[model samples]
Target: MTDPSQPEDTDPDAEDGFYVLHLFVTGASLHSTRAIANLKQICESYIPGKYSLEVIDVYQQKALAEQEQLIALPLLIKRMPLPERRLVGDLSNTEKVLTGLGLSR
Candidate 1:
């Protein structure tokens, strides 16, 4: 569970309507590595400095992963900007990711 007393618990971009994303991964597996690279590229291209991504390694943060109720690795959760979204996969499909992030119409 996240401590509300911690500064990291607060969202910095909530006021600006930017993205607060959490990507749950497991170690250095091929899919996790691919998802990391793909997510970074997509954020840099689409949201630029407007997004905050927290890549949580499920192996290291098992409790947090369970808290998120993650059923799959390489899961992307959009936490802010209202109406949260989740995507599961290597995130190779840019169009699908963009649409999920509400970056493209």
Candidate 2:
């Protein structure tokens, strides 16, 4: 049972809102590790229960990297929302990361 008039209707598929992210890393490098940590911290602190992070090791998953056309290591791609965005780096820049992910600073 649900109310069609309510704008806050609950969707099990997207209950907490959806965030599809792909983190492309070269391997178990410092940058890769930092990017993963920073992104995880940010997501958990700010957007907890509302984000999906997928870390892809380019060395192991070359096909996925090529599919995404990644030109740099440690690239973060926001795919769920419209007008997808991309950020390249270790992901230590909280302001930039938040902004790129359509979040307020």
Candidate 3:
């Protein structure tokens, strides 16, 4: 379903739809680094030119973290495609990440 808050033209199901993802991680921690790498790899492989990923460091961006209501070190939020989903982890597991992002095949 499409999110009511977003514009109708930004729908993820559109032929040229783009995913908007937010990844919040603690600065330079091992898990954070891994999450970044894993998420980037996944995005490149699965959604290549069709996604926009924003990486935010909680240590540096406390306000943004608070806005997202984060309660974990490394968090991934699928902000588009409606029914936003949040996953907390280093994102090392491909299958799990794919499923969480609704990209599992």
Q: Give TM per candidate.
A: 0.83, 0.82, 0.83
lDDT pick, better of 1 and 3:
1
Local distance difference test, candidate 2: 0.81
Q: How accurate is candidate 1 locally (lDDT)?
A: 0.85
Q: Provide the clashing-pair count of each candidate structure.
A: 0, 0, 0
Each prediction's Cα lDDT score? 0.85, 0.81, 0.83
Give lDDT: candidate 2, residue 87.
95
Winning candidate number (lDDT) = 1
> Which window of 10 residues has the lowest lDDT sum in candidate 2?
6-15
Positional deviation of residue 101's Cα in model 1 after best superposition, in angstroms: 0.4
Candidate 2, residues 1-105, lDDT tens digits: the string is: 666643332233332457888899989899999999999999898789788899999999988888888888899998866447899999999999877776642
